[model samples]
Target chain A: MGNLLEIKNLNVQFDIFGAHVQAVRGVSFELNVGETLAIVGESGSGKSVTSKAIMGLIPNPPGKITSGEIFFDGSDLVKYSQKQMQKIRGKDISMIFQDPMTALNPTMKIGKQIMEGLIKHQNLSKNEAKTKAAELLKLVGIPNPDKRLDEYPHQFSGGMRQRVVIAIALACNPKILIADEPTTALDVTIQAQILDLMRDIQKKTGTAIILITHDLGVVANLAQRVAVMYGGKIVETGTLEEIFYNPKHPYTWGLLSSMPKLHAKTDKLLAIPGTPPDLSDPPKGCPFAPRCPHAMKVCVDHMPDYTKLSATQKTACWLLDERAPKVDPPATIGVGGE
Target chain B: MDESREKLLQVKNLKKYFKVSRKDTLKAVDDVTFDVYKGETFGLVGESGCGKSTTGRTIIRLYEPTEGEVLFDGEEIGGKLSTKAKKNLSRRMQMIFQDPYASLNPRMMVKDIIAEGLDIHHLVKSDKERMDRVYHLLETVGLNREHANRYPHEFSGGQRQRIGIARALAVDPDFIIADEPISALDVSIQAQVVNLLQELQEQQGLTFLFIAHDLSMVKHISDRVGVMYLGNMAELAPSDELYDHPLHPYTQALLSAIPVADPKVERTRERIILQGDVPSPVDPPSGCRFRTRCPFAMEICAKARPKWHEAGKGHWVSCHLHDDGLKK
Candidate 1:
């Protein structure tokens, strides 16, 4: 199948205190229709920035797209005007934020909040919008949708508030939904419920999804394809099986090993030492070279080229460099080690 | 695995009710009882507002218990302790808060924060001695001694947490209550903090009541785990047994909800998505608080609260499904 969305050679930068901070650099990926693509990274790894760039949500003045082409349905979105982007934002692409309490307006009733999108995008009348809003609430599994529509945000629980947010996101029937850590604030059970709800909705509407999260567990079950991001770049990209079973990047290995497994029997977890590098004055070569376990002398001197492991898998690491000697990941990492 | 010794920390029918309004009392923690072994990590796992944090605070006397006796080292705390006695007992217990960012004073330097406990207890004689103790505490938590002079804002989130650990350790307490210490940290940094706590527990022979929202991490670090729901403990068991054979329906649904990192396992595993949100703590359900959302709830569940009793060796559950064996 052809790609639904393709982002090639993307670069995003911010001018802060008379210095350019390269947030995202040379990132490339493709999302197929009806596929759930996950972008996983720690804070300041530019995972959110990449998603924001794709949605044309980057705030102007300080934030700028340095160089890249974001193609949606064979049309470059980077060239679209603000007026043009506004029309496509809620109608073609929708985003769900991390905190639902803050994302939702406290004063307005949830029914009105959801109806704003339907009336604006679908051009529904007041009464028609209210009726459609209740239907959307029911679709998102809100109990007694008609009665609860009159209730304010404070009356709902954390999980229920998120369900309302999901309802708002789906009000316009967008072709793409970008959920940025929608479940991070919720408990495990509620997180599971929200993930399942998203999967079910995606199946029903055939909307492509971009799930952004720091938790690898969410990506493992929800996403069809996985993109491991680090230091403003796609360090590794592959199918879920290939990423989980045979990961090629050391950063991906650290992520897998650092996660506390529910079934594994181990005394101590293997933590990756050191923090993410400073983005203001990034290193000359590989961005993750400072924290990589298999860091070589050449890694500091030159950036490793992207090596194709398969038609669907690729990694950028010195260990994968053809001239470099093969170095295996630790034995403790079960599936993703050589 | 000795089970015959006197309990180190015994809580009897603990209750912590918060008055949200004049007419309403939120039962944040209601009618809970448990025991922590001498040198084991007792984990409290639950969702938000489930009274896990309240239970920990009530045990430590951070929040005055509405009704309960917290027997620590064979002595019941709260109102019973005289002023001098409370001061003496303060040296034996300490607590690490959840949010490292908000818990630490941004204006104070790291040394003063760690040395606050030492100064309170009068552990050090001179200023130099206090600085030495503070530096040693920083080193013990895998932080550099040079960071002693820096402010909390100068460090990263993980580093601030290390400072929090340093502060908790300065008192050299026998028991520590880590209330969701790693929940606020990054995933990569969480393991580091957990490992540090494990090592500290072993070296100091300190008992811990680790309260967290993540069940997988709780299972990894805790010897015994307790599952709480709306101010009541649903089940308590050994870590391995709790993960392997969860008896309570709430626990089964909880364990099933943890998303595995493997796609194959995730696709194949059946997830029991609970239908409703957690009932409000204020004016909670009449009998079993979890009955409102429980899939296997029976009619009797709403009539009376189930008795919390031992179902098997080292396993306890509070549910009506196990009543047949109890009756027999």
Candidate 2:
């Protein structure tokens, strides 16, 4: 009901060499309490950058949140100092990184890794942290938590290591959990297990989640709401049903249609022509205009404002405008069989 | 359509075991058998450590077959052959690796990377001919002549993959082993590569052994699909029949495991989440390799290997549940 995190026009940039790469261009979204909001996009679509900016994990030298505000818990996180962010990071907002294989420290014991956050954030004693760490491991469906605590990361399988990563993120019992491609590296069956675990954990803890992924299937499985991002901007934001069944943006359509349904009858996929625009010299107007089939002259010349389609759905496309020609979506766009 | 066509490649009891240590051997592709029709994409789907990639590599002669026969064009190509025969085999059967960035030579220009096959086989006559062929190959894969002069670093992931396709096509191979070719590319870009592969297959009459973990894409492109688990072929049938009426427990579990990109379907559909992870490849489960994780695993599944026999018309499966003799 209440907004847990509100990101308003967040802009992140990387000054590599002399050219400036606009990673996140005026992105805005809100995460409601105890809701799963998935940010779906390809690589370099600014989903990860936006999540990193929320946690103050952006490296200052090359990468910086150049503009915009990250309002979390009624405070502007944008103005927060490094020391201030460090205290709030593990305690109130926790993150499960992209790659579980490299996320955990290979040399450190799994118990110590989980306990580090607990001790630092909750100010728990060494013995208390150890007990809590074991409990967290068991909660994440790891077998023999007490015995497994002493094991190193390499000793665990890929799926078990990911469970350990989740345990660490859940160690402090943070109010908000940000999982970035948590199941990408795992197999589909293992991914299904992890997704089920996350859902069960969310139901128990009531922790709001920001799930960043490229796989739309994973999004459909876990997320209640979806944000379609392309070329450093959020092109469409809607409820899961709206995005999957009634999408507006051409990029969203392309993304949905590009992937074949498991029982898809079509022989060829309706692939979006060309590639994503270079961030260093991004397009003048809509980022997806180059690849969009319904791109009008106005689309290339100027960016379209977000048109409110429904109470929960909004899209930034010239096709949604009243004056623009009404173009119907492809017959194969909707994912469901019916 | 497939029965009438000749078999381009027949893999009979193919085995590729790697000696991890003196005692332990990793059976990467143990006694895997399948046939690729003259002009069809034979999709091989499996999870990680399932030996799909190893099977593809073994067929292309990247890794020598530890045991078994690989008959390509009615000739026994798997056995030890002369250097000239090996060279000729390499030209006839090309490979496109998974990682486009790592597969392509970063040091060399795109022209040279694509022309490497041409240079190796001495397909071109002169300097002009080599350059011309390189340019033509680049265009064939949707890239321009200008891109040939540039290095691999300058291209995007999708472009690099296109370049990889160009390199494979440079030799004009009859069969191509595309091992996870579109896995590295973006979601939107993956379709482009898939469409490109389909077009190339149609135009050139190329027979492909499409190896990937992505089930949906495999079903879309492949004519006949094979399911593999722990270096063993679980099921093999036409793509439609394989997906619609999967007989093997492993194949059914695998098909259900995939998350479809539909909110209504994903929310309502029941998923068969297999307990535990895939066992270590060094020492896989005995008898039926899938028995450990299979929900419908019977007692006999652990005692003896299931016979790899035809379940339905053209649908081959290896499972005790499908074994009529065992059922009796």
> Which one is best on lDDT?
2
Candidate 2 lDDT over residue span A1-338, tens digit each: 99999999999999998999999999999999999999999999999999999999999989998899999989999999999999999889999987889999999999999999998988899999999999999999999999999999999999899999999998888989999999999998898899999999999999999999999989998999999999999999999999999999999989998998786688789998998999999889999998889889998989999999999999999998889999989898664644
For each candidate, give its TM-score against the true structure. Answer: 0.97, 0.99
Listed models, DockQ each: 0.60, 0.82
> After superposing candidate 2, which stretches have Cα over 4 Å from the reference?
A335-337
Please give the lDDT score at residue B86 for candidate 1.
78
RMSD of every candidate to native, in Å, equals: 1.9, 1.1
lDDT of 2 by residue, B195-241 (tens): 99999998999999999999999999998999999999999999999
Clash counts per candidate, in order, are 0, 0
Q: Would you list the clashing residue pairs of candidate 2?
A: none
Give lDDT per model, in order: 0.89, 0.92
Give the per-residue Cα lDDT of candidate 1 at B264: 74
Candidate maximizing TM-score: 2
Q: Model 1 segments beyond 4 Å from truth?
A: A17-19, A334-338, B325-328
